[model samples]
Target: MDSDRESNSSSSSTSSSSSTSSSSSSLSSSSSSYKMIKAKVFIWVDSELKDIYKIDEKLTWVEQKENIVTKLLPPLYKIVNKKYSITNRKLLKMLYGRWRSRHRTSNIKNQGDERVKQNKRRSSKNSRMQEKKKRRAHATNYLIENKNKYILRYPEEDLVKILKDSGYHSEEWEETDPEEEWPITQSAVVEDDEIIEEAIKQKSSSIYIHNKWWRSPALLRLLHDRIDPTVELLKKKPLTLKRKRAQSSQSRYNTSNVPPIGVPSWCLNQDALEQFNYSNVNIPVYDYNTDDQDNSDNDIEDENNNEEEIQNRTNSS
Candidate 1:
């Protein structure tokens, strides 16, 4: 009985130790479950706070900050320490403000970038247009310079072509060609004759005002007016008056009293007077003498032919 009592007491002591260890294990398990539940509850509370504290939806930067502060910070605060949680909120707000400011600056810079690109594109397009205009202007100048070589050489045709090539409308040149074709409607011939007269006046040989090869109408007219008085005086009193004065004495002498200047008395014979007399009348006498000789020869031939006929008639009778 004593040994059984000892064994029962020892069994009772082991049962008590086992029961205490089991109770301790149960307490530890319940504490772990409570901590897990608290962690879950804290996470849920953080999510709710994030939704409640969100800033304007348009301000996504601020919204992100609120999410980081509320949803993401609490867990980190628990791991780091509870004392830093208050300080983390202030730091988070400051960082979010700085981030927002930087974000706004970046947005402004992006707008400036777009404006610069647009201006560059516009400037490039304007420069290209200016270059095209310059090229077209050069082409027009070249055409105008070469207009004289046209097939028609008509100013109206040339004017129309020039206006057409220069980008002007046809209506702008509607009257240009016709106007050139009938340049002076009322008196073209008169104008042309006037031009010819002016040209002739300017082309005088002895009229050298400036010794130039050509002169304008204005210059030629000035020169003519300046020199006209002297030319008129020269025409009124010509150099032929001196020759007439010298010949007056020669006509006063008779033909027989005027001997030849260079004649020698020994060489002067009657043959010269006869030769002179014959030579002086030779042309008139030869002209009349040819007709006289021709009439005498015709009369002799007629008498001879009449005598032959008379003799023949006598012989036949």
Candidate 2:
């Protein structure tokens, strides 16, 4: 009875230990699953290492970056953790902003509004004509405004460099308000038009100007005036003055005194000229003698008879 009690106690202890081990393993797995559900990290992972990992929410920025680096580059993980570091807020904001920008989309309603605007632009003729008129007006105004001040139209970057090279500081220019320096007004436009005309008149005397200034308003106005005159001149033939040849007093021959060559007597006689100028020059004459006429008639009859015989032979064959 004592031996059986000892054996039963041993078996009971072993069974309890096995059950406890299984329950502990189950609890650990459940705790890990709960942590994964709570943490909202959506990082891309390698297929081979796609296992869920436990992350601490209270980790420092540097610790988070290190963690990310470790996960992404495992081979260099140890080196980075030991040497590299980054602030938590900056890294988080940077990554979040980048991802959001890349993945963000516009609403369908906004896209529909844009499509409607495009369709209206395509279908309206009045709108297109108005746009063209506006463009021409703007171009004309631009031409008038920069007539004498074309040199001042350099790009901001180039202007800045030029100012620097000339020992002029930007601070001085910035301190002086443009309104105070040159007040703009309605009369400025009128003044610009007058200036453009004056500049065009001045440029008319010069043959050429700098290529950069070729498209200036003054030049355009000059070209317009020049083109009209040229077109009108082209419509009419140019007048050519007939220069008289001066006679030489010492010369032996004189064109005025020279006489024309005379025509031959044969040329003057029309009937004789026509007769000799033909391909059949030999004229046929009828003989008055009866013997000669009879011989001629006989020859003609013989030719007629031969031609008839040849025709009959060809038809029969």
Candidate 3:
């Protein structure tokens, strides 16, 4: 009975210890699984972050430096490979050394794959650029061969349509005159006196008025009256108008010849006829003498003009 009782106790102790060990194992496994899931979630989040941008499909040097140190060495190898023209046993050894050091690095297992992916992407880009250059060269050669026939000068809309019919992709060209593009109204073309005054008032630049007195006849006469005394004092010399002495016979025969308008007259501006001075003030005595000579010359010119007209008419007939 004693032996059986001891055996039962031992068996019970063994069963309890076994049950405790199983429970502890289960708890440890569960904790490991939780830790693995958390680590995976952190990695996924870090990978997707925009600030964690990649270079050459893998993380950039900045990103890898922050998260994965082991990937940094092979990229250095690539840089050295690009920079130095000498590709020899030394460079090969250095690359091998980096590649082998990868296995010894404990923390970053993904570094090797990142470097490989970067190299592959870089290779693809180089190949694509080479292909593009080849295509461009071929296209340029084709264009050069047919430049005279294929090239269009100042191409119009119809040329674009023709190109499109011949399977070319063409964009629309815009042609517009710069002057006609301004938004000028018809009223602005025929501006009124008020508008003209406003424009002159707003004008910032100086205008040279050639004979501004000609625009206002009243002002011109007022100026002439003001400056008359100054003119009389200028007696250094006087330029006389050339005149022909009237033949005594012709003078008597031509009583019907009225004086032409604006003849010289000192008698016209008399104060007794002040109102008539403005209307009938003859040209200045000196100016009238000059003008009379010009008129007689003009009459001679008119006779010559009539002769030319008669000759032209006869030629035409």
Q: Is candidate 1 or candidate 3 better by lDDT?
A: 1
Over 188-212, each residue of candidate 3 has an lDDT whose tens digit, in order, gives: 3235544532111221211111121
Model 1: residues with Cα > 4 Å off, grouped in runs: 1-59, 79-86, 114-317
RMSD of each: 62.2, 48.5, 50.7
- Winning model by lDDT: 1
TM-scores for candidates 1 onward, in order: 0.16, 0.14, 0.16
Pairs that collide in candidate 2 are: 61-88
| Cα lDDT computed for each candidate against the true fold | 0.37, 0.33, 0.34
Model 3 segments beyond 4 Å from truth? 1-12, 18-22, 42-47, 50-317
lDDT of 2 by residue, 1-317 (tens): 64454345445544543455478569879867544522322332223234633233344435655555555435323332353342444334544443343333222224687765544433342343343233333332233232212211222232223222311110100011224333333333236446532111111111111121112232232223212222232223442322122223422222222111221221112343353342323331111122345555654454355446545765788
**What number of clashing residue pairs does each candidate have, in the order they appear?**
0, 1, 0
Question: Cα lDDT for residue 220, model 2?
Answer: 30
- What candidate 2 gets wrong by more than 4 Å, as runs, is 1-83, 106-317
Q: How close is candidate 2 to the true structure, as a TM-score?
A: 0.14
